[model samples]
Target: MALLFWAVGVLAYLVAVFHRQSLSVAGLDAAERMGVSEAGMATLAMLQLLVYALMQVPVGVLLDRFGSKRLLLTGALTMAAGQLVFALSDNLLYGIAARMLIGLGDAMTFISVVRLVNLAFPPHRNPLLLQLTGLIGQLGAIASTVPMIASLHTYGWAPTFYGAAGVGVVMAVLLIAVLRDKPSGQAAEPGLKAAWTHPGTRLGMWTHVATQCSAAAFLLLWGYPFLVEGQGLAPQTAGVLLATLTAVGMVCGPVLGYLAGRYPLRRSWLVLGVIGSTAAAWTAVLAWPGHAPLWLLVVLVVVLAANGPGSMIGFDYARTFNPAGRIGAATGIVNGGGFLASMSVIALIAIGLEVFDDYRLAFLLQYPVWLLGVVQVLRYRAKARRLLAQLDEGLGEVRGAQEPALGTKALD
Candidate 1:
C-alpha cells in the first residue's frame, strides 16, 4: 500500500514535469503562436518560475497542515485547468495566465512527494527513494525532448496541450481513489516559525541555490535556444542533446544518492564538486572562440546533468536538520533557493541577450551568482558544523551529569 501511494504521487509528478516542459518543447511554435520575440518568450517560462518560487514556502506550510493527499489532488486539478486554458486559447495573456497556473501546481509537487516518502518509508530508505523518484521523474522530461517536439508537428499545438492537461485530470481522480497520507494520524504542530528559524534550513537553501539553478536555466529555457540559435545545431539534433542531459542525470542520481547517504556530514563536498565542475565546463564552452567542439559541449552538458541530482542534497540537509514535523516547510525553503537563482539568471540572460546579442556573454551572467553562492554554501557548512558541535557538547554534558561524579560519590 505504501509503495502504491508513492507510485501514484510519482506518477503525478511525472505529469507535472511533462506539463512544465511542454512549452519549452514547442519553443519556436509557441513564439510564433504568441507573436513574441525571444525575450518575450522567455517571460512565459520566467513568470511560471516566478510563481513557483514565490509559492514554495506557502505550499510547504500548507502540505504540512493538510497532508499530501489533498495537496496532490489540488495541484493536479490546478495544472489541468491551466493546460485547458492554454490549449484552447491563442491570446498571449491567456498563455501567460495558463503558465502561471501550471507553475502553481508544479510548486506543490516534489516537496509533497518528498514529504510523502519520509512518511511512508523508513529513514534509511528515504535517500534512495528520493533519488529514484527524481531520476524516474526525468522520464517525463525525456519524453518532452523528442516525442513532444514530434507531437507538435503531428497533431498541432492545441491537441498536444489538451492531452497534457488530460493527464493531470486523470491523475487527480487517481489520487482521490488511491492516495493515503501517513498512518500516524497525529495532528501537526504549527512549526513554520521553528523551521524558518533553523540555521540548517537556511544552509539547505544555499546548497540548493549553489547547485541547482544552472541546470534549471539551461534545461528549462535557454539550452534549446542556445544550441539551435547560438551553436547552429539543428532543432532535432539539439533535442537529442537535451535528451542526453536527462539520460545522464538518471545515471548519476543513484551514485550521488549513495555517496550522500554514506557520508552525511560531507555532503556539501559533493555540492561543491558539482558547482566547481559545472563552472569549469561552462568556462570551457563559453570561452571557446566559436561554437564549442562537440566533445566539449558533451562534457558541459554531462557536468550540468549532475546538478539535478546535486540539488537533492539540499533536501537531505533539510531532512537531517529538522524534525519530521517541520520537514515540509524546511523542504520548501530549500527548494525555493534554486528557482530563485534560476529566476534571477534567466532575467539576466534575457537582458544580456537584448543588450549584446550574444549568447556567450549572456551565459557569463551566471558567474557572479556561482561565486556568491559558493561563499554562502561554505559559510553555512561551517555554521552547521558549529551547530552540531554545540549539540554534541550539550549531549555530553547531559550524560556527564546523569552519571555519578567520578571522585565525589555515587548517587544516593
Candidate 2:
C-alpha cells in the first residue's frame, strides 16, 4: 500500500520534471519561434525559475495545510494548462507567461511528493527512497533530451508540447483516483517558524545551493547551447551528451543514497566533494585552449551528474533535523535555495553571453556563486553540528531517565 501511494506520487513528480525540463531541448526552437534574442530566451527560463523559487515557501505551507494528494492534483492540472499555453504561444511575452505558469505549477511538485514519501515510508528507509525518487524522476529529464529533440524535429513544436501537456492530464486523473493524504491514523504537520529557525535547515539550504545550481542551470538551459554552439558539437551529439548527464545522475543516485544512509554525519563531505569536483571540471573545460576534447567534455558531464543527487542530501538534512510538523517548510526553504541560485546563475550567464560574446567567459560566472554557497555551507555546517550535538546530549539524558522507569514497569 505504501509503495502504491509512493509510486503514484513519484509518477506525478516524473511528469512535473518532464514539464520543467522540456524547454531544455527546445531552447533554440523556442528562440526561433518567439523571434527573441539569446537574452530574451534566457528570460523565459529565468522568469519560470524565479516563480518556482519564490513559491517554494508558500507551496510548503500549502502542502502542510492541504496534503500531498490535493497539491499533486492541482499541480498536475496547472502544469498541463501551462504547457498547453506554451504550445500555442508564438511571441516572447506569451511564452514568458506560459513558462511562468509552468514554473508556478512545477513549484508545487517535488516537495509535495517528498511529503508523500515521508508519510508513506518509515524514517530509516527515507534516504534511499529519496534518492530513488530523484533517480527515477530524472527519467523525465532523459526523456526531454534526445527523445524530445527527436519529437520536436519529427512532430513539430506545438504537437510535441501538446503531447507533453496531455501526459500531465493523465497523471492528474491517476492522482485523483489513487492518491491519498496519508495512512489512516497519521496527522499533518504544521508551522514554518521552527523550520526556518533551525540551523540544519539552513545548512541543507546552503548544501542545496552549492550542489544543485550549476547542474540545474546547465541542464535547464545553457548546456545544449554550450555543447552545440560553444563546443561545436552537432545538435544530435549535444542531445546525446545532455542525455548522458541525466543517465549518469541516475547511476549515481543510489550510490549516493547508500552513502548518505550509512554516514549521515558525513553527508556534507559528499556535498563538498561534488562542489569541488564540479568547479574543477568546469575550470578544465572553460580553460581549455580551444574547444575541449570530447573526453574532457564527457568528464565534465560525469562530474555534473553528482549535483542532482548531492542536492538530495540537503533534503535529508531537513528530514533528519526538523520535527514532522516542520518538514514541509524546511524542505521548501532548502529546495528554494537551489532554484534561486540557479535562476541567478542563468540570468548572469545570459548577461555574460550577451556582453562578452563568449561562452568561456560567461561560464566563469558560476565561480562566484559556488564560492558564496560553499562559504554558507561551511558556516552552517558548524552551527548545525553544534545544534545536533546538543540535541543528542539532551536526548540521551531523557532516555537515561526513562529507561529505569520502563524497566520498573516491565518488572511490575
Candidate 3:
C-alpha cells in the first residue's frame, strides 16, 4: 500500500515534468504557429521559469499548509488548464499566460513528491529514492523531445497540446484517488521562520544553484535554438541530441544516487565534481574555433545531463538537515536555487547573443556564475557538515546519559 501511493506521487511528478518541457520539444512549430520571434518565444520559456522560480517559497508554504495530496491534485488540474490554454491560444499574450500557468503547476509537483517520499519511505532509502525520482522525472523530458515532436508533426498544434492536457487531467484524477498525505495521522505545520534559519537549507540552495543553473538554462530554452539556428544543425538531428541529454541523465541519476547514498557525508564532493566537469565541458565548447564537433557536443550534453541529478543533491541536503515538518519549505528554497540562477543566465545569454552574435561567447557569460556557485557550495557544505556533526554529538551525549549507570562504583 505504501509503495502504491508513492508510485502515484512519482508518476504525477513525471507528468508534471512532461508538461514543463513540452514547449522545448515543440520544434519550430511553436514560433511558426504563434508568429513570434526567437526572443518572443524565449519570453514564453523565460516567463515560465521565472514564475516557477518565483513561486517556490509560496508553494512551499502552501504545501505545508494543505499537505501533499491536495497540492498534487491542484497542481495536476492547474497544469491541465494551462495545457488546454496553450492548445487553444495562437497569440503571444495567451501563450505567455499558458506557460505561466504550467510553471505555477510545475512548481507544485516536485517538492510535493519529495515530501511524499519522506512520508512514505525509510530514512536510509531517501537519497536513492530522491535520485530515482529525478531519474524517472527525466523520462518526461525525453518524451517531450521525441514523441512530443512526433505528435506535433502528426496531429498538429491544438491536438498535440490537447492530448497533453488530457494526460494532465488523467494524472490529476489518479492523484485524487491515490495520494496519501501522511503515514497515519495529520502532520505538523512547519515554522517558516525556523526553516529559513537552518544552515542546511542554505547549503541545499547553493548546491542547487551551483549544479543546476547551466543545465536548466540550456535545456529549458537556449539549447534548441543554439543547435538549430546558431550551430546550424538540422532540427531532426538537434531533437535527437536533445533527447540524448535526458537519456544520459537517466543513466547518471542512479550512479549519483548510489554514490550519495553510500557516502552521505561526501554528497557535496559529488556535486562539486559534477559542477567542475560541467564547467570544463562548456569551456571546451565555448573555446572551440568553429562549430564544436558532434562528439564533443555529445560529451558536453552528457555532462550537463549529470547536473540534473547533481542538482538533486540540494534536496538531499534539505532532507538530511530539516525536520519532516519543514521539508516542503526547505525543498522549495533548495529547488528555487537552480531556476533562479537559470533565469539570470538565460537573460545574460540573450544579451550576449544580441551584442556578440556568437553562441560561444554568449555562453561564456555563465563562468562567473559557476565561480560564485562553487564558492558558496563549499562554504555552506562546510557549515552543514559542522552543524550535522554538532547535532550527532548532542544526540550521542544524550544517549550516553540515558545509558544505565555501570554500577554505583563505576558511576561514581
Candidate 4:
C-alpha cells in the first residue's frame, strides 16, 4: 500500500509538473504572437507565481483538513480548467486568469506528495524519498522542453494546451479512484488546530516558502533570460537546455540528500554555498555578452542544475524539525514562502528591466540575492544545530534515568 501510494504521488507530481512547464512554453509563444515586451511577459510570469505562492498556505491547510486524495482531485480539475481557458484566450487578462488557475491547481501535488511520503516512509528514509520524487518531477520539466517545443512546433500552442488539459482530467480521475489520505491502521484525523498551532513548525514553514520563492525569482530573472535571449538559442534548443538543467538536478537531488544524511545542515550549507557561488559566477561569466568562451554554455547548464538542489537542502532542513503529524502543512508553508519570495523578485526585476533597457546587468544583480539566501540558510543551520544539541542533552538525561530504573526492575 505504501509503495502504491508512492507511485500515485509520483503520478500526481508528474501531472502538476507537466502543467507548470507547459505554461512557460505557451507563454513564450503567446508573447511572440502578441508582440509583448520582455517586461510584459515577465509580468505575466509574476502573476502566475504570485497566485501560486499566495495559495500555498491555504492549500496546505486544505490538504491537512481534507486529506491529500481529495485535494489532488481538485488540483487536477482546476489545472485542466485553467488550461482550457489558456487555450481559448487571446489577451493578457485571459492569460492572467488562466495562469492564476494553473497556480491554484498546481499547489496540491508537490506538497501533498511530501506529506504522503512522510506518512508512507520511515523518518530516516524521507530525505532520500523526497530526492527521488524530485527526480521524477524533473522528468516532467524535461518533457516540457524538447518534447513540448516539438509539440508546439507541430500542432501549435493551443492544441498542445488543450491536449494537456485532457491529460489533467485523466489524472484527476486516477486520483479520485486510488489515492488515500492515510495508510490503514494508522488512521487518525490530522486536525487543523494542532497543525496550525506549532510555532517552530510555522516558522520553519515560512522559512521554506521564502527561500523557494527567492530561488524561483532568481531563476526567472537571470536564468530564463540568458537562455531565451542572451544565448540566442532557438526555442527548441532553449527547451532542451531547460530540460538539461532539471535533468542534472535529478542527479544533484540524491547526492545532496546523501550529504544531508551524512553531515549536519550547517556543513551541508557551507558546501552548497561554495558550489552555488561557483555556479552563479560561472553563469554570469557565460551570460556576459561575448565573454563566455565556447564551453561556457555547457558550464552554465551545469550551474543551472545546482539551483534546484540548493533550495531542496533548505527544504530538507525544514522537514527535519517539523512535527510528524503536521508535515503536510509544514511542507506547504515552506514551499509557499519560497515561491512568494520568487514572485516578488520576479515582479521587481520585470519592472527593473523596463527601466534599465539591459537585462544582462539586471540578471547579474539577482545572483547576489541567492548568495544572501545562502547566508540566511547558514544562520538557520547554526541555530538548528544548537537547538538539536540541547535536545540531545535532554534526551540523554531521560535515557540515563530510565536505564537505572530498568536495571532495578531486572534485579527484582
lDDT of 1 by residue, 145-197 (tens): 89988877899999988888888999999999999884344444466778777
In candidate 1 the C-alpha lDDT for residue 101 amounts to 97
Would you list the clashing residue pairs of candidate 4? Answer: 208-334, 209-334, 209-337, 209-338, 210-337, 210-338, 212-338, 213-338, 213-339, 213-342
Error of model 1, residue 338, in angstroms: 1.7
The global C-alpha lDDT for each of the candidates, from Candidate 1 onward, is 0.81, 0.85, 0.79, 0.64
Task: Please write out the lDDT profile of model 3 over residues 35-108, one tens digit for every residue.
Answer: 98766777888889889988887877776667778888888999999999999988899999999999999998
Model 1 score (lDDT): 0.81
**What lDDT score goes with residue 48 in model 3?**
90
After TM-score superposition, the amount by which residue 172's alpha carbon in candidate 4 deviates from its true location, in angstroms, is 1.0
Q: Write the per-residue lDDT of candidate 2 for residues 1-412, one digit (tens) a residue.
A: 8899899988888898999999888999999999998899899999999999999999887777778888889999999999999999999988998899899989999998888877777665666677788899999999889989999999999999999899999999999999877423323334577788887789889999989999998999999999999999999999999899999999989888777655544677888899999999999999999899999999999999999999988887777666677778889899998899999999999999999999999999999999998898888877765765555522111111211111111100
The segments of candidate 3 whose C-alpha lies over 4 angstroms from its true place after superposition are 182-190, 385-412
lDDT tens readout by residue for model 4, 1-412: 8888888878888888888767565556777765677677776677777777777767766666677787778888998999898888787788778888888888877877887887777765676777788888777776766777788889987898899899899998888778777533332236335544433344344344333443355334345465666556666666666676778778877776566455442434434553465546556663566635535666666665665665665465355445556555556666776776677667666766777766565555555555665565555545544555555411111111212211111100
- Candidate 1 positional error at 158, Å: 1.2
RMSD of 3: 5.7
User: Against the correct fold, how does model 2 do in TM-score?
Assistant: 0.93
- Pairs that collide in candidate 3 are none
Q: Give the distance in Å from residue 169's predicted Cα in candidate 3 to where it truly belongs.
A: 1.2
Clashes (backbone N, CA, C under 3 Å), per candidate, total 0, 0, 0, 10
